[model samples]
Target: MSGGRSAQAAIAIILAGGRGSRLGGRDKAAITLGGERLVDRAVSAARDGGALAVIVAGPAAAVPPGCIGVREEPAYGGPLAALAAALERPEAATATETLLLSCDLVDPAAVVGRLSGARWPAGADALVLRDPDGREQWLAGRYRLAPLREGVTALGAVSGLPIRQALSGLRIAWLDTAADDVADIDTPEDLDRARARSELGAD
Candidate 1:
């Protein structure tokens, strides 16, 4: 533990399997913000957050250096499927916690650091970040790996399952943060905003 924080070592698994239909079917993970691909930024943030390892759940070829990449079965499977696949990997098996993130976060490292540094309530299974509007950013959370694995195992054949369905019963602790911290790039205009924010050196 760092300064009374949880001692669990974290493995970051970034979900990058989205079809990006809103971005004209382009690979959103490869989209650039301030000259850096979204995937690359996510990887760097995870590292900065003290992740023991980083994995990208999507096209292997597109992932940044120093990160492993895996894909869910039946390409285009939803985030839950990608998460399930990530949990099965050897790195995750050895990890005490998992930092789950989507590729489009503008400040993933900050979210990861905040969640990792928090002292979760006794028996809490996860720590999820929430926007100012009180909307949970499910993908931007830190989960106890054992509970996560058990949850996934309890729901058999999770391929294509919606995240809300797959993770419904877990005990989640929510931390309310600025909307910008949890904002994601979905459309081109969102990308533009993120780029502008990046140029401003905003987290």
Candidate 2:
């Protein structure tokens, strides 16, 4: 179970429900890097990595084919709420685990493959893909459904809660990966850099 494949039947949950305020309110998922939208790239990577299901927690109108559409409460609720909404789906509860991904990943395949094939300790609640600088990309993780749901439920008022708050106290295993592989397009400058990287075929 290595090299882009996983023994667990994971469900990929792409958090595309953000307001994209940093990019002047533009839809990050719809923005094109190179020739493909970020959401499309994420969906492709999840499917390519052997995810049995792909759930996009954002605008249904923008979601690409081969993915299901779901939005969080309050229209622009944060990732926490968006994640809660995704968990309501039957697949999430039934799947062995869930792969949580932000829609703005620059190299979803590399990140997902690495995380999926990494060692998951017996008691570890989640496996986070950390950047070279050691910053945990909370969204780039694989979490056990039971632990994730327990975490989310333990913290009341999940709507509008920060992701860190939602996932606090869970035993996590971090896989330090190349920063470039986990780069996320959050601002206009980030978008430009991603485009430049894309043009150079640097993943």
Candidate 3:
């Protein structure tokens, strides 16, 4: 609550809302890598990134034990839908800022760590990570809560507003990192690449 930013009360929503449709209906959240389920890695990433609480937005029954799994409002909609559902939750209903995360990410902890230590300008509304290219990885970004309604409005007008477009006109921190900044386990090839990269980094 330091002048509208969370000192230690930040809220984050892990958008584990998808069913991994592209992965042939596998539960991407539960997929394991390096001896732990994918969701666990994502959770750890958020916690490590400084989220006090993380709402696993997906099927309640599928969430692993010890994780607070809440049902996504519209069930497997778009990223905007997932964000809207998170805002409805009591925690985000009054939150000043919420960092949104995607489950299929391979290095949740890495991304979170970089983002957790990020600095923003005065009155910043969102902190985003972008690659050297201009593609906005909205799924892997932090956003302020006050403009959440704007995100909702954008989603309604479009099938799915790009995460960056939703935060237009707000003070934003556009972070630039390597291509791995927003990498996720979306497909078999993506998974293989991530694993290979992990192996390379370890060596």
Candidate 1 clashes between residue pairs 3 or more apart in a chain or in different chains: none
Q: Per-residue lDDT of 1-203 in model 1, one digit per residue for the tens?
A: 23234445778999998999998998989888878888888888888777878889998766788788889988888898898888888999988887899999977777777876788788888889989888888899888888888888888888778886756578998888888889899998888888888988955
Ranking by TM-score: 2, 1, 3
In Å, residue 80's CA in model 3 sits off its true spot by 1.2
How many clashes does the backbone of model 2 have? 0
Compared with the true structure, the alpha-carbon lDDT of candidate 3 equals 0.71
Total colliding residue pairs, candidate 3 = 1
Backbone clashes in model 2, listed as residue pairs: none
Cand. 2 Cα-lDDT: 0.85
Q: Name the best candidate (by lDDT).
A: 2
lDDT of 2 by residue, 88-109 (tens): 9998888878889999998898
- RMSD, each candidate, Å? 2.0, 2.1, 2.9
lDDT of 1: 0.83
lDDT over C-alpha atoms for residue 55 of model 1: 81
Error of 2 at 107 (Å): 1.0
Best by TM-score: 2
Runs of candidate 1 exceeding 4 Å displacement:
1-8
